[model samples]
Target: MRFCVSLFWLLSISSLYGQTAREIVQAADSKMRGNTSQAQITIQTIRATWSREMTVKTWMKGTDLALILLQSPAKDKGIVYLKRKKEVWNWMPSLEKIIKLPPSMMSQSWMGTDFTNDDLVKESSVVNDYDHSIVGDTIIDDRNCYIIQMLPKPEAAVVWGKLLVCIDKKDFLELHTRFYDEDGSLVNTMNASDIKTMDGRLIPTRFEMIPAGKPNQKTVMVYKAVMFNRPLDDAFFTTEKMKILND
Candidate 1:
């Protein structure tokens, strides 16, 4: 009788310590995006033959609103991209025109980089649009991580068939993510590193995206500065604001 009681207690304790996969994903997602965020970033595109870099400032309000303004590189400076809910638009200062992006263009590269338009705009929410499951645990960069598998819901308009996300157990930081196509083929991989304290939060400051079958091609984004939970108005995300962004 005592043995059975002890076993039951052990099982109960184990259950108490376990967390649902969705909860784990939500915790990690929440850390990356607060109520509002402003940051300066440098994007580097590296290829076998040539490479280029661009600096930009980004403002994000929740998951639905974002604005990116190119800051450096004389040719691309003053360009702005605004994402409001489901709509996306790009304002080209050189052409003096605003171009609306269609749904079909979401998968295209953003500014000739490995990151797609959907990635920069964050059109889909991983926690809400996908069913998450913790497949296993692994170590990355000497940090313990949870290997999570996310499958998109039938109604979710997402491009990736499956996503394998590696989140550090210590701080709930997303260390790596592998994206797969509908055919179960690898599309690309994104790895995060260079963890440091930014905006009073410890997070990864560098992200690298490498395409499948292209070992020599990749894009890296390094965060120079970040401020979270800053006050930002909804009007700042509008197309009208995109045109007048000077910095």
Candidate 2:
């Protein structure tokens, strides 16, 4: 009886010293404390036997909202994905039309990655869509991290039902994440590695996503030319400039 009591006290004490895992998960969704920034994007995707690359000029006021224009590989140039508030639109250069992305499309294939189009452009806030509760604390990549599980709020319009995210204790960078479907089946796993410098920020240099059911299947993305807080003219986000890249 004494041993059991001692163990309980030890557990209670540990909780007092540890940060809730949910806080780490929220770090990924939290908005930056500043205004917009322009970033030069370099994205390379590979899945199974297929490989492709794309370049984009992106502008984001916050992590959850952005205007991204595709520029690369000689074919998919001028394609724009814009997220404003709760709505997301995609402009196809071939069709010269803007179409609103349906929630169902968010789960569909995104380029070659296991992530859906929704995953590629995460312009929605986790705070607004889901409730985060810290399950426990864990060590990820030798850094103390919080392992938070996020369950979608009933009123939230997002698709994913749950996500387990591991966040760094110091920098709050997302080290790893796991996604699940509404039925609670494991769907995909995402990891970021190879830290690099761009625009003076030490962000994830490589992003990899692997589907749960597929064997030997994974998508890798390398981010380069990451400029931070660069001044961009308002004209850059206009349809006129988008058309030039399309032409």
Candidate 3:
């Protein structure tokens, strides 16, 4: 009788810990994206032969709306990408055209960088699209972290088969993430570092995405400045607004 009682207690504790892991994921994701945010960012693509950088201003509202306007690289200036709901549109100032990105193109690299269109638009939410579990604990960048596993739901319309994420236990910040393919092969890894106070919140100031097996190639995004929960009109997320906003 005592053996059976201990087993039941162990199982109950395991179930409760799983719930806590999911909550931790939710909290980390919320810290990265508030109700509304605006920021200046720079993306740098490093390669063996050459490297390039682009600066942009971004505005995001919840999980459904986002806008990015390229500000530097005279040739690529004035380009805009807008995300509204599940659709994403691109405005090319040179071509004088607005192109709607199709579902098939969601996996393509954005602006010739390691980040895909889905990454920028965030078509799926980690908290809602995956089952979370606490795998173990590790230290990353001197911060003790909870290693969490995220398995995609059967009906989730996402490309990643699984994700291994490390969240700082103290502040619930994502310190690193490894993405796997449908075949369960590691495809890419993202590391968040250089933590500091930005816009009144403590977070990672830089993120680096490195493709598996490519030691010399990577993409880095650095946050210049950010403001969370700012007042932003819904109309700012429309395609028309994307074309008109030259700044």
lDDT of 2 by residue, 100-206 (tens): 88777777886555667777677445656777766667886787877777888788777687988877677777778899999999998999877665556556667
Candidate 3: how large is its RMSD?
1.4
1-247 per-residue lDDT for model 1 (tens digits):
9999999998876554344777888888878788899999999999999999999999999988999999888899999999998888999998999999998898889999999998888888888889887788999999999999999999998878999999998899999999999889999999999999998999899999999999799999999999999899998788889888973
Tens digits of per-residue lDDT, candidate 3, 14-38, equal: 8998899899999998898888989
Q: Which 10-residue window in model 1 sums to the lowest lDDT? A: 12-21
Leading candidate by TM-score: 3
Candidates, ranked, TM-score: 3, 1, 2
* lDDT at 118, model 1: 86
Off by over 4 Å in 2: 1-23, 30-34, 231-241, 245-247
Model 1 residue 61 distance off true place after TM-score fit, in angstroms = 0.7
Task: TM-score each candidate.
Answer: 0.91, 0.81, 0.95
Better of 1 and 3 by TM-score: 3
Root-mean-square deviation (CA) per prediction: 3.6, 4.4, 1.4
Please state the error at residue 101 of candidate 1 in Å: 1.0
